[model samples]
Target: MPMPASYPTYVPRKQFTQYLDDYVSHFKISPRYHRSVESANYDEGTRKWYVKVRNVSSDEIEEYHGRFLVVATGETTDAFIPEVEGLNSFTGEVLHTTQVQIGKGI
Candidate 1:
């Protein structure tokens, strides 16, 4: 489905999340959220990926086996600020892309 014309060229995070939720619901995709991966290893003998995940809320650990494993680290998971010569000398404010909030401009 095409996005609405009211959406801007660059959709906001909340809008994008809602779109993803709608797509998941429409496709009947069951994705796990708020789970921390403790370990992921591929067994050569079984030829399968074994993943150990812990639920953040319940602190329960579960093991899952899959033929294919996809690791998706979000774009803004880590903020990187390159070290430039004389960058500290500037008195102006410096902000990273991850630190910028919607509707707030520097």
Candidate 2:
């Protein structure tokens, strides 16, 4: 999705977060946070996507059907750091993509 014109060229972390919150609220999008997808399968006959999601907190599983299913992992979940030779010896700072703050010398 294109960024809104009102957004500054270098949007701050909080501002970007607020923009997302506003967009979701304005669009009445229902996002299920903290839920893990157990399975996702597309049905050609019905042309719909069937997905099974499990709530991480309550351990409850639920089924959902939709025209589209988005799998957005990684950034919402834990950051993975692969082991590299001499990484510990390096003096430079290491930050994940999600940890980067725009216009802050990232």
Best by TM-score: 2
Worst 10 residues of 1 by lDDT: 84-93
Please give the CA lDDT of all the candidate structures: 0.72, 0.70
lDDT per residue for candidate 1 within 4-91, as digits (tens), equals 5687889898988887777678669789889999987767678777889999999999899986665555575587766644447644
**What TM-score should be assigned to candidate 2?**
0.63
For model 2, residues 3-78, the per-residue Cα lDDT tens digits are 5778888889998898778868866989888888887666768877788999999999999998765444356557
Worst 10 residues of 2 by lDDT: 97-106
lDDT of 2 at 59: 99
Model 2 bad stretches (over 4 Å): 76-106
Query: Which candidate has the highest lDDT of all?
Result: 1
